[model samples]
Target: MRIERKERADATILHADLDSFYASVEQRDNPALRGLPVIVGGGVVLAASYEAKAFGVRTPMPGREARALCPRAVVVRPRFEAYVEASNAVFDIFRDTSPIVEGISVDEAFLDVGGLARISGSPVEIATRLRARVAAEVGLPITVGIARTKFLAKVASAVGKPDGLLEVVAGTELDFLHPLPVRRLWGVGAITEAKLADAGISTVGDLSRFGEHGLCSLLGGGVGRHLYALSMARDPRRVETGRRRRSIGSQRALGRRPKSDADIEATLVAIVDRLGKRLRTAERVCRTVVLRLRFDDFGRATRSRSFLESTDRTDMIMAVARGLLDDAMPLIRDRGCTLIGLSLTNLDDHDSIQLTLPFEADHGAELDIAMDQLRDRFGRDAVTRAVLVGRHHGDDAPMLPD
Candidate 1:
């Protein structure tokens, strides 16, 4: 499951992402929630209605903080089954409109309508109709981006958010993209933006003027070339649908409170266990590890590492996840924790048993495998992490944004 980066910018594609998907769904279902700030998550903010967003409440924010921002906001727990049903309905619309639809997440997808121009109307028309239909039938706000390429379409959707529709005309892509901040570029993260800002390149226009050669020297050969081209509207990438997603990940809110080291470790192991089982079931091997942590103070951190070989072993993933957690111990201790997650990438189709290191043989791999099998045959609750058994004692602890 390789997610190929957009190599060119001429591929006609549209990326449609729901606005505050979970929270919007809840609000839509509950009449009393209309026009009120709504936050979704058990202990943390999984999604926030646009009304909450105006108050600076955001996903992954601690529930306490979200409440502080919008004192009158109503909080709701996530209804995953309801979300799945809504997502299926949305996908059904995508299928009827276009045959090439690529789902990026539960809330977002890319639609290829190059061949549907005559039957489905223009891309802009299709996007408008789709957005209205989603609101009418699914009772959710959806933002759409219609562009000549996937990257630009995704960027457009991001820019026109909270139930917006934006189109980057084929020839005016550069004009539309240049004024935005450098962070709007897909790969330009905090660190990269800092580097660009250090070089007096603050916007896409500035980066474009910096030229590919200069950017290559600043951002390495590969990134510099790709970004400069994107800035200049020279992308030629295609819309790839049905590409198997490389990873599946989940996180839980621990509530906005300090967690003991043991509690954190237990949570990490549980997440790794869940993700590892999914990887194994997919018959996929992942060579990269990703860790995400959210702190009580509303700060966020992420770390990733690449492995020489791919593996789906719980022990292996957990061991690496622990190492990553250890690396972030100082920050976690200082800020306290709210949420943690794990994801594996760089996936391959191979499902063969990988040889274990001599030291790893003692890492409880056998027991974990046995438990996964038994749980698969019996039920998820048949075997539970011992730490969770007595967690009621710590129930009074701070809550993370659920």
Candidate 2:
């Protein structure tokens, strides 16, 4: 059954994305790094400036390989605080432009400017002003893509990267989208792109011609239908604001170095500690613990466990996380894990948890609250788990606010 989608007549949705966000932040703060190849993070390439990207430097690549690719690149450790501050400033501009804003990450957002045609001018005009404001106010390069649909807007922004603005007018979206490579479509990652390439479907037009049934036969139902819809420029989603995050999590990239079981456990402990603090601070509780591993070969594995009841206690969440990690250890050992991450999912407001018996005391919860208070009062380093005392957990990757 094909459901008809009526897209907006005007291209009002804007996708504003900061170029090479972390690396750009570094470059903006240091005049010497501007226009020069810059890389953020010494162990892993968190971000690379366009100058470095021209030399094939990409995120998650090991520092050694990145240096080999761009020897002149100035590598700097990630300062997440600075990135967060810059993100806040950019988002402030987003809100000032439009009340309907959907933040995709710390560096990108979707905004609906449909109703501001009179007061703010056309979408293109608003985008130009937005770009100017970000440069004048925050001193960062942001690309804005305006389209009738969120998907197309995001794609336009990607095409008009490194400080540019593009608008895909209504009735001409197909003309703009069809000539692009299949990889430009959402959900078409490297593996999917390879699969499509094997079948000689290289462009969006080719995929659209292949039809949904053919794609389903090749790529399974969900992904195939999705790609076909996108190839036809059929996205109907609108910019949504005030959406609370469904999950709170953190991950640490461990470079291509062999780690012992103890080392892995310590990393896990540190991650859980940070997540627990964040969850409690947000007044949320999670019922599921998920462990994500990226192997040295770049293959990924995920193992998750859900509890009957949700809690914000660090010890309880860590216990489940440890169990999931334990179950995945054999696979990690075989694959040579290079990264470890955790997500606390199935979240709800703290008030949703049923009241405990009046006399039933949760010492673990008390401890968690106490520790969070100390961390809040002093600093994140004020309290630490014994397991993470002397271990280097690596930088906490910047993320959207929970």
Candidate 3:
């Protein structure tokens, strides 16, 4: 039997990404900050304006280093509420533009406009309108890339950044992607790029010529096959909406200074507290507690413990997370800790748990509910743990919906 493969005949996928999202929002709200180099967050650079980036400033860089790089840059604390409101407004516009919209993060999304050609005109027209709408309505600049495949669309958006629009027309995907450096590929990070460079493969065209067999021999089979497929423009992914997350997590950067055990434990408590509240709000329970640690040398380690049953109780999850942290303390002390993070994985809906008669009332559960109510009525600062009193926990970074 002979089978014919079917593919979309036109470029209909759009990768819309906001330019320097946090910094852009800061610039949009404050007229005085406009056209100036801006850096968000004081301890660690969360986001940098295009002007600051021109001077080699980047996110996650130490504030001290960034200041040295761009002396006149204006540093500001992140206003998460404003960023969230802006993200919601932009997503609303995305939904209005296309019924099939997949949100990647707070600042990026993939929109599929495959069947709207007759009514909405071409993909280029739709992308133009989307960019204009975001600038006029949200008062923020956004760049959009239109292509037949999601990978190519994302690549195009990256190539045409800082409020630009680019289109990779059908039948010209290879022409557009091959000349770019291998680093432009989605999964090629610093280590991978170094490895590719060692092999004398610098561009996508070089990678394609290396062939899948050669790549599999050079790299591992899974990664080699993935990159080879991308080099050939063979992505078949569809834009998905209403997707659920498998894990919920948060982290805090503790800077380069040495952190005492007490300080690290306190930070863990703060992260667990926030994650617990988020879990209950989303009506999800998790069965695994994972602790992530980064050392001053940039090496990373992870520790995790699974519970017998899924739980949304703050105390139970905290107990497990603390245990994992305790186990990792030796490594942390040896390497000198730089960051700590926690993740609740193996998630399931709260409704899925079977109800059982309790021998005794769950005081911890009651306390969690009470604290959540108090924070809801008042603000997040209304309720704080005794250990967290007078301690600066830093701002919570915004995340995509769990």
Candidate 4:
């Protein structure tokens, strides 16, 4: 008797995620840390091991709290460089498995294994081999989830946490998802969770049972309908590399508090200079500048300006950011700022420069270029702003791109 093979449509996509990435890396590197609770971050928990997570430790929680939860937990500062290296190695393995890889983050990716079933065995077999290779070579544990759609594949991986594998067949997605809580839907946070709870809509089944009109009446049109659609596992999004990030942003903590205007200006200028160089290196230009401010009271505010034309000029970016600062200065003063950040959005990829307005009078792009060249030739510290040096004690030098 001939047995029928599983349909190719049933197993196509795979979501691979490293298990407790940072904490696992620390434990893998040091044998003594194995089987013990591990929390990784400088002053807080960037990642908590499964062992520590049992005690209610979580990422971004204070290190003191994590230690209090699991007194035997080994706390280690984050080794970002090491994590990046391991991520690259794991990605190489992903590329070997399939060409259609979509990276969600450094530690997770969606792989299109649709065409590989002919030569590479079934999706389950491929996932097993991929996980084994990563464990044997990269020395890290990872979980793999296989499903017909990207959304369900990610949910499967989440359900199979900490080095497990789960697969949901195509027609069984609703059966697998409806029993879960509404919080499982993307963009449903604490606020929305409470709102859903108030409406007696707790699970995905409840949301589905509420029907479209009921959802619209309760949560309004857009978000309510969106959740209703997802409750039925109706996502049509694909796993393609076509979706590139439109903008890149970085934020730094001031640690204590900022004092003067000039000091804040210097910090803003440095950040803009760094961000501009990165944009140029990526050959992209941004038409919008955003300034983010976090007050001592933990309130955050953002101000943005859209430019008529896109430019990656360091001085120009800072000038716009400074203009945003002037607009938000009163609020910043009223609520003393604890953190300041800069971001450039509205990006166009590798486009020709569209010069509309005249460049600022006092600014010098040549000086910026010279500094860049010096940093390229000698080192990042070869050039520096005198104001940034020794202005704040224990302040480290700006990081140069590798």
Q: 1 or 4, which is superior by TM-score? A: 4
Q: Which stretches of candidate 1 lie above 4 Å from their native place?
A: 1-11, 42-44, 62-64, 189-203, 213-223, 286-335, 350-379, 390-402
Q: Candidate 2, residues 1-402: lDDT per residue as tens digits? A: 122224558898999999999999998999999899999887678899999999999988988899999999899988888988999999999999988888889999999888788899999999999999999999999999999999999999999997999999889999999999998998999999999999999999999999999999999999999999999999877677888788977877777778899888998998899899889889999999989898877889999999888888898898999999999999888888777889998899999998768686558888888898898899888888788887776586733444
Flag regions of model 4 displaced more than 4 Å: 1-8, 62-75, 254-267, 329-339, 355-366, 391-402
Tally clashing residue pairs in candidate 1: 20
- Using lDDT as the measure, name the better of candidate 1 and candidate 4: 1
1 against 2, candidate with superior lDDT:
2
| lDDT tens per residue, model 1, 1-402 | 323443333335889999888887888788899899888875778888889999999766678878998998888877776887998899888877777788777788888877666687778888889988888888888999888877889999999997899998877888899999999997898899999999999999999999999999999999999899889866565556667765667676788666798888777777776778877778788888888887877788999988778877777887788899899989999998888777787887765556656964475656767888988999765787776565432111111211
Over the stretch 1-402, how does candidate 4's per-residue lDDT look in tens digits? 112224455668899999999888999999999989888753446688999999999865656667888898887766766888999999999999987888888889999887777899888999999999999999999999999877889889999997999998878888999999888888689898899899898999998998988888878899888988888887766677545566666554453345577767777766776788778777888899988876766688999998887877787887899999999889977887656777788778756775457665745656767777887799766777776675532221122111
Worst 10 residues of 2 by lDDT: 1-10
Report the lDDT of model 2 for residue 104.
89
Query: Lowest lDDT 10-mer window, candidate 3?
Result: 1-10
Compose the digit string of candidate 3's lDDT tens values, residues 1-402: 222224679999999999999999999999999999999987678899999999999978888899999999999988888998999999999999998888888999999998889989899999999999999999999999999999999999999998999999999999999999999887899999999999999999999999999999988999999999999998988888777778888878777887899999999999999999999999999999988888877799999999998999999999999999999999999999877888899999999887778998768888999999999999887999999998978575643445
Model with the higher lDDT, candidate 1 or 3: 3
Which residue runs of candidate 3 sit more than 4 Å off their true CA positions? Answer: 1-7, 399-402
lDDT of each: 0.80, 0.89, 0.91, 0.79
TM-score of each: 0.77, 0.94, 0.95, 0.85
- The Cα RMSD in angstroms, rounded to one decimal, for candidate 1 relative to the true structure is 5.3
Residue 366: error of model 1 in Å? 9.5
Question: Would you list the rank order by lDDT, best first?
Answer: 3, 2, 1, 4
The most accurate candidate by TM-score is: 3
